[model samples]
Target: MSMRTYVTWAEMITGFARSGDSVSARRFFDQVPTELKNVVTWTVMVDGYCSNGQMEMAREVFEAMPRRNFFVWSSMICGYCKIGDVEEAKAIFDRIPVRNLVNWNSMIAGYAQNGFCQEALKAFGNMQAQGFEPDEFTVVSVLSACAQSGLLDVGKDIHNMLSHKRIKLNQIVLNALVDMYAKCGDLINARLIFEEMTERNSACWNAMISSMAVHGQCKEALELFCRMEKSNEKPDEITFLSVLSACAHGGLVDEGMEVFSKMQKKYGLEAGIKHYGCLVDLLGRAGRLREAYALVKSMPMKPNDMVWGAMLGACRIYMDMEITEQVAEDISTLNSSIQSGNNSHYVLLSNIYAASDRWEKAERTRIEMENEGFQKIPAHSAFMPCGA
Candidate 1:
């Protein structure tokens, strides 16, 4: 009822929300006297629900509020964006009486993160047009959009604008720049920026290593990863994934195995399904199909579509119908939706069967896929703009 109690309740709710205990936050919020619930308290409750992905609860809290602030409005926008409901986020953004930089950044980030690169770029333009100077978060989000859409020219323009305005590039902005350049196939520029950075954090190293692996510079990627370790930066899951991918591409079987072992043994990071998939791909590329299959069988966790997909791809490459059939049987046992959509595994199996001169088996596979209600998804390629 008092101002002191109000402040304490607000802080407690915030702490609970930050710790992912939305139930406690809501309970605590309910205990606070209705008369004591200020706009800040209401906003915190709304934010807690939003952070926990309980949009219905968030909206209920938001709608029930006697008063709303800029932060609550921004939280709603952010919540919608996080859940990939950009249309709703945009609606909320449009309804804001006045928007701030945080609101604008949240909108751009939502669009970019959910693969709406063009919308993100458009929103970035709108924000700048409204005279809100792009901050580090804004710059990074916009650059990520550029990277996702391969808008190299647009990214270059942003970089030039930053240079023109003499804005100090922080680590995140620099990393975004490197990512944008690298994803746009401008490895030269990406590397140049990477080499010039005085403060190379784990993220900076990850950007370069991933870029190199993606562009088929497997040897260079591995070398950069080694340099990352020598600089005393600890490799996280992303770092290992990139390193394993590089080994797979380079056909470095021994190196890949060592890295895979090091991940679990030395670093104490569990090798996730993706790491297992990369290792399988590595072994498969090296004509170690049986070993790959054995590893899959021995996995601690259930193999997902990616892991199985990697195995199937290897089976197809080696024309190993035996393993292919086994993979098909294994996939059939799972309650996954792998067979419910445009099933690549089924198609791969049919192709493998046909490739091995087993037309009947191939036809049988197709029939089975059809029975499972899966149609082949047409292959498509992404279209990049000219000179991008």
Candidate 2:
């Protein structure tokens, strides 16, 4: 085939791969002459397989290649990372003969995304030690690690470094920065960074709103939601979840109902299970147990354990034995695995019984829980420093 035809075939391969049709891409790939296949062509095939979750096939083609490009290596790392196979990604990273910023960033992001915050931080330190300057992507990944681990000091160090280096904070990096500060309990810094942003997207708005809501600054969270609307950024499902959470926390029953209505009617978004749970919690907290139960019954989707758990929580708070019994029965009807995993529901029901001076029922509930193989898993906390 002519060079032009080969280019067309390569483009077709990419097009197929991008459309999640890796089989077609492989058909075109196999048609290419061995001598005419370049590094770009090889990389595309590997990437296509990886993109389609055909990692074994990707590795097969990768191994068969007479030569490897850095892009191919990065694709392998990214593919493994996408599958939560970070150990294999690290193995690929360790094999890279000449490491670049992309390689380091990929490894760091893989670790961070997979909840290996400590490993991500160690990789960040190592990257810097090797005289590589972190770009926006690097900063964002490192900040995510710091946020996940609540490494406030390390987050501060990265923020200071950004100032010293004068790196132009792109929206992604700024959003990550805001998220890091907010998650680390530095709401003051979080708000400051948020205000400094000249352009705000949904993610930035969601981060700030969620942070405030989680920290019991319900009024402020609502205020920020208002600002988000005024700015014309469409509030997605995540935004509404945060808004509903704020209402629940603040006991803003009327306001929460209005927001919940607006989520479906005005915004044309469906109220997900979590959204329903938040609204249930909102009403349940305000001692509107009957209304909350009615709402749960009216939901189009079957209420999950979370939704039922929220109802049980309110029952526990108000000592409503009737609703507690109903919610507990509803929970028992769910999939056995879900029921077994959430012993908190059983515990809450038993507590409500005990609180209402029904000792026999509480003991019976405990015995039932034990018979169902529900063990109350001990809660634990870990203080994982970013530098670790």
Candidate 3:
């Protein structure tokens, strides 16, 4: 084939890869002449495989390459990272003769994705020591790692670096920064960034709303949701979930109901299991046990453990033993049928029995839990600074 024909084939392969048609891309690759399979062609093919979740195929292509460059190396490592193979990705990183900024970013991102926050931080330090200037992707990955690990000091250092480097804070990076601060429980700094951002996307709004909701700032979350609507940005499923969660947490029963209804009517988005759970929790918390049970029954799909647990919690709070028994029996039946590993349902049921002064029933429930090897996992807490 002529050079023009080769270029045309290469473009076709790239398009197929981008569209996630890896099978077609592979077929196209099979037709390419050995001489025409350049770095770009191979990289695109490998990326296609990786993006399509065929990491094993991606590795085969990576190994078959006669010569490897930084992009190829980074692509393969990123494939491993994407599939949660962090150890293999790190092993590749250690062996690369010419590691670049992209290589470091890919590895750090993998570590962060796998919750190895300390290793991600250590990798970032090592990248800087090796004279590779961290880019926006690098900063985002490290900030996320710091957020998950609750490394306030390290998060602050990264924020300062962003300012020092004069990196333009785009929506993605800004949202990550806000999320880091929010996760670290520094609402002050989180709000500061929210205020300074002249442009906010759905993700930014969602992050802020979630931060407020999780921290019991229901009023603020609702106010922000209103402001978000006023700005003409549409709320997606994530946005509604955050607002509903805020309402559930703050006991904003009326607000929660209004939002839930609006989600279906205005946005035309069907209520998923998460939204249903929030609504049930909101009603149950407000002593509307029957309403909550009615909502659960009305759901098109069978209620999950979370929905049942929410009802049980409400019953426990109101000491409604009559309803508690019904909900507990439903939960027990569902638990037996689905075999979901959530022990919280059993614990909640037992707690309800104990709270209602039904000693024999509570002891029987405890015995049942023990026989099934169900144990209550202790809750753990951590503290991190809001911003570095």
Candidate 4:
């Protein structure tokens, strides 16, 4: 290889950056002659750092760059957003002297991914106001925000806009539409869009099936899963998750067991903790507390709060003080390892202890809960029968 044909510094930097070896990427950047350094080189390094989650280092490189381009600025925004720092991403987005499609898309995605659905919708409106059209990515992100936030009208408008503009619906876009409608409690529209899709992916099927399951249409959800299996498209773990959830919700214990076996025996996918949690919940609901407890004890991995919580709920069902105490202890151990809503577990355990004639222990548990700044939430009940 002649020196004349040496790979350009830009190419080397980009390769290293993309490969996630920020250390090597930075070293290559350092060796480049200062005068030889261009915007591409700087952007590549910053992008590498950001992609590898070295946000602070990315900022350092970004600040030191003599000149910055749209990509560099946009990448920084994306990096902050990727790390769930939407506020900072938004601030940078606002400062861009000349915003482009990429910048707007990043901001919209950031807000949507971080659960700032209202902000995402507002950004979408702003993008349109600035004469920028929504591409598939933009459409998907906005649709997701709408789906999660229950902005059904906005989601429908987006669907209508695609039709009016004669935009082609790809698999991902179609999946998003289906998901949005389903999650917004518009299963009829979801089914309509799903039927219209010329092409479908597992996500599209899973979304519709999950929608059915969510709405207590487990039988129909199972039918869809069977249809998917009949086709060439293989069910992924997420697909099985929906299937199992449907079985659990419908109280189809035998079916849930069969599907659970198929997930590993036929599909060759290992059961994750989430699947076990669902199974335990199903058993708990079916009054199979002993089986649920045995399953939890036999788990290959450490049971999380959700799994123990399910068993605890089962103990509450059976009113087995000894087993309830054991599950309560596991939940207490999980409280230190997982950061989630453990108040229900604590309260249930306290109540169980009190009911089981363990008054002193119940008081101690209540005191521990108070030390953790939790109070017994007052139970309230009412019936509107109709929607409020």
Candidate 5:
């Protein structure tokens, strides 16, 4: 190919990377002359593959490169992290000749994303020990890990670092901070950050609203959501889920329904299984069992385990054996087809049988679950430490 043609292909590959079209990027890459495939081109392709969840393909490109630089290694590690392969990310990290802030950030992000909050913090500590300063991405990753693990003290320390260092909070960092405080049950700090943000994007609003909701501050969450509307910011599916969950927790049935309807009509966002689950919970809590059942039945998509579990809970409350049996059947069918659905269905069905004084049936369900080697474990959150 002529130099002009090669340059055009390279530019096309850059466009594909910018647009997150990894497939097209690879297609364009294949047309590049072997002699003309520079490190920059390979880095772009690696990044595009990572962003598009093609981590293995990214690895192939990374390995095939004539020479690998820090950026190339960081790109592959970040890709592995993005796909929740923390171990693979760490392996890449282990091989890097020199680790930069970007390298540490990738590992920190990987640990945080994989629910290793403590690990992420440890990684930050190690990064500092190696004479590297924590940047915005570092702070964001650690704060997110704190949020997931509810480590208030660690979160507070990070907050202090940000303030002492005078690190201006960008939207992403600010959102992570808000989430951390909220999960740690410090709504005051969460609110302070939320109010102090100079430019609040939709994600900022969603994080604040979600933090409030999860912390049981439904009234405050609702108020903030309304304020978001007044600010003319459009709510996404996540925002609606958080707001509806708040209403459901507070038993604000009317408000929940209004929000649910608004999500569909105003935002043009279709209600997914999660939204339906929240609505069902709201209606079930209000003793509108029949209405909840009808809503579940009328859903355009198939009701998942969560929906049936909510319905079954309501049936147990109302002692409605007929619908309980129907829900049990649905649960069983769902279990037979989908592997992950089995535990929740079995648990719900056992609870339903137990509530109705059908001890024998409940016992049978337990035995069956045990025979299938389905043991439900209590959920626990942990933080892992990542190192530079």
Candidate 6:
């Protein structure tokens, strides 16, 4: 092939790498002889492996690169950070001879995305100290980290900082701020931000409604759904999911049914499994186990584990031994391994039988949990770290 042919092939190979197809990238890279295997070509291979989550392979490629540039080093840092290895990513970041804004932003985003909230906040602080003014990317990632780790004080501080910096409040930033406040149990301030936003999109409305739903303001969430319906922004299936979830939590059975009906009939939105699960939860909360079961049976798509789990939970709450047995048997048949491993179903079933003085059945359930090797999780758990 001529030099022009090599350039065209190089572009094609790099395109594969850029899109995370390392297998194909390597295959194409092998076609190039040693003489034409430029630094850019090798760096693309490194990026490809990194994007595909093969950090070791990325490292190998990086080491082999005769001339590594900023992009090559930064991609490795990002890969390490992407996989929750912040210490390694930071090591690479420290070695960058002359880091630019993109490099800084990548580090901040990496820490935040991997649940290293404090590290992300520290990076933001460090960036400002180095005389680099934060753009929208920096602020947004920090806001998300604050939201994830429930750093309410830190989140509030960031909000204040954004205001202090006179940053234009984009719709996404507003949504993130609203989500942070809601997650922090500060609905009053979340609502204030929502109401103050100049423009609202589907995502923004969904966030506000979801926040209200999660924070026990179910009625307010439904009201926001109504407001979304009336506005120019059309409520998608997710909007209905949020609304249905609100009704389920609040025990608005009638309202839940109406919304479920209208979502299909009026808005032309098809109910997904999550929507069905939420409706099941709504019915179950209202002490309508049979109705919930009928609805589950009526679903076009087979109800998933969550839908069955909801039914099992409901049967437990109502202390319906017969229904619990029936549902438990159904669940065991459909997803035996999953139901066996899940403590919620087993514990709830055992307690239901125990409440009715069926001590033998309850004991058997506990024994089953032991036999199935699901007693390892210790019955209750939280995924977050201490101090987040």
lDDT of 4 by residue, 1-388 (tens): 2241124887888788888888888898898876667888888889898888789999999988888899988899989989988888888888888988988988999999999999999999989999998888899899999989888999999999997767668888899999999999999999998998777788999999998999899999999999998977899989988998898788889988998999899989999999999899888888888888899989999887778777877777677887886786776666742377457667667666666667687777767777777755423112112342
Encode model 6's per-residue lDDT on 1-388: one tens digit a residue.
5654556667877788778787888899778777778877777778888888899988887887788777887799889988889899998889888888788989999998888888899999999999898877888889889888878998898888887788878877888898888878888898898889888888888878887888899998998888888999999988998899999888889999999999999999888899999999999989999999988889998777788778877887787777788876876567654643556666666667767777778778778778767745333223112352
lDDT of each: 0.86, 0.87, 0.84, 0.84, 0.82, 0.82
Q: Across residues 1-388, which tens digit of lDDT does each residue of candidate 2 receive? A: 4655556767888999999999999998998887668877888999999888789999999988888887888899999999999999999999999999999999999999999999999999999999999988899999999999999999999999997777778899999999999999899999998999898999999999988888889999999998888897899999999999999999988999999999899999998889999999999999999999999989888887778778888997888888788777766676433544767767667777767777788778778877887667322112112342
Identify the runs in model 1 with alpha carbons over 4 angstroms from their true place.
1-5, 338-342, 374-388
The predicted structure with the larger TM-score, 1 or 5, is 1
lDDT of 4 at 289: 82
Residue 178: error of model 4 in Å? 0.5
> What's model 1's overall lDDT?
0.86
Candidate 2 C-alpha RMSD relative to the actual structure: 5.1
Q: Lowest summed-lDDT stretch of 10 residues in model 6?
A: 377-386
Which residue pairs of candidate 5 clash? 116-384, 117-383, 118-383, 118-384, 119-384, 119-385, 119-386, 123-386
Clashes of 5: 8
The collision pairs in model 6 are none
RMSD (Cα, Å) for all candidates, in order, is 4.4, 5.1, 5.6, 4.2, 5.8, 4.9
TM-scores of all candidate predictions against the true structure: 0.91, 0.86, 0.85, 0.88, 0.87, 0.81
Q: Model 1, 1-388: lDDT tens per residue?
A: 4455678889989999989999999999999887677998889999998988888899998988887788998899889888878898888889888888998988899999999999999999999899988888888889999999889999999999887667679988999999999989999999999999888888888888887888899999988887887787899998999899989988989988999999889889998889999999999988899999999999989887788788988997888878888887887788344544547676676677777778788778767767876655323212112342
Clashes of each: 0, 0, 1, 0, 8, 0
Error of 6 at 207 (Å): 0.8
